[model samples]
Target: MTEPAWKSPTDARAEFRGGLRVPTAGWCAGWTQANLIAVPRALAYDMLLYAQRNPRPCPVLDVSDPGVVSTRLFGGDLRTDLPAYRIFERGELVGEVADARAVWRDDLVAFLIGCSFTFEAALAEAGVTLRHQEMGVNVPMYRTSLRTLPAGRLGGPLVVSMRPVPASLVATAVKVTARYPAVHGAPVHVGDPRTIGVTDLDAPDFGDPVEVRPGELPVFWACGVTPQAAVMESKPDFAIGHAPGHMGITDARDSEYLVP
Candidate 1:
């Protein structure tokens, strides 16, 4: 995928002054991508607690202070740096915009959560084919009966993203991703949807489902969707997320966060 053209220094500075600009996910090739959420400072600790309680789904990458736009951990300016942002008001997605300037607030604290994009580079390195990238569609995801530990006002079922791996490569995929426990780690379950409460694999709750060939297995992962599910169920007054495929690129390399 071609990276989006970088704006001129003057244009970038102007954007930072006026508002934030969303970068295309393709722009940050090889860098770890992240899912972002901004919440009021009063609820920050509670949300962090929830993330801690459910590490598989809500693996945290970094957390920013109230009114602070710069994320020191990822070397990013929260205001206009990501590729896109989804704004939710009273649990409803009000808009999908490139940046979060109009609704930026001083009392908001930003949270950066680990995303499966962190491991995509590794998968590619191992020669595992990614169906979504090949077909130019978003990954398939679903809400499962698996429930996350409740913290403060946050509590809900777990959401997962799916990838169809060849039967021969399933073990390799698991072995490779198992090294990154802090960013979702290993597969929660494999080959069976009913075990996870999925009635039909063809119709996913989110994203497009890819075909499982004669020799392929439908492997599921604990997705970054856990946070979004919490948002939907708890109905946070307001929230923000990165647009699908467009993630917040960071200075952190994929290997650094691995458990070894």
Candidate 2:
């Protein structure tokens, strides 16, 4: 399948800022994608501690100073660059918007968390089929029975994105992804969805569900969405996050996170 027209991270950010809303999975192929979570300065420490404690699902790439939008990894305006943003009030999702400037606050500190999508290019190059990309839908993500380690006021069940990998290519997918440890490398669980308390693959906690072919197994990976889940369950007064599958495209290349 041909990739999206926006090959550069700057182009993708500009398009998103211009109100082009779409899941970012295949947008900037070799560029790294990140999960955005902005919270009050008072809560930033707790959030950072939570991520450090639960590195699998919350590997942090960069964090902004209070109210800052641009970071070394991302140069676009955080409030308007991502395709979609979710605004939360006391842990309730109050709104999802194309631009977050209206709800953004001066005391908010943003975090750019590592996303599993960063390693997808490597997987595709290795011949592992990406069903969600082919189907033109966001990856399916679930809130699993596994719980994350708590830090201060942040904690919740782990969130995972599921992909159906052909049984034959599962090993290859694992090997290719494992090289990018900063991007939630490798599958956390494979096979039975029920094993992880995901009773229905079609009904996910976040994003769209795709078909798990007969010869394919449902593989799960630690998702950056876990922080958003924590914001919900932990009752943070205010928070902003990228709408499930809609991520922030970073200027950094995928190779920057790959290990030799």
**Model 2: how far residue 176 lies from native, Å:** 1.1
Q: What is the C-alpha RMSD of each candidate to the true structure, in Å?
A: 3.7, 1.5
Q: Write the per-residue lDDT of candidate 2 for residues 30-120, one digit (tens) a residue.
A: 8899999999999999999999999889999999998588898999999999999999999999999999999999999999999998998
Q: List the residue pairs that clash in candidate 1.
A: 20-80, 21-80, 23-82, 23-83
lDDT on C-alpha atoms for all candidate structures: 0.76, 0.93
TM-score, predicted candidate 2 vs. hidden true structure? 0.98
Candidate 2 error regions (>4 Å): 1-6
Task: Summarize candidate 1's per-residue lDDT along 38-155 as a digit string, tens digits.
Answer: 8888778888999999999888989998878867666657766665678878778888776678888899888888888778667767878888767767778889988889999999
Off by over 4 Å in 1: 1-27
Report the poorest 10 consecutive residues by lDDT, candidate 2: 1-10
Clash pairs (backbone) in predicted model 2: none
Q: Which candidate is the best by TM-score?
A: 2
TM-score of each predicted structure versus truth: 0.87, 0.98
Question: Predicted candidate 2: what Cα RMSD to the true structure?
Answer: 1.5
Quality of model 2 by C-alpha lDDT: 0.93
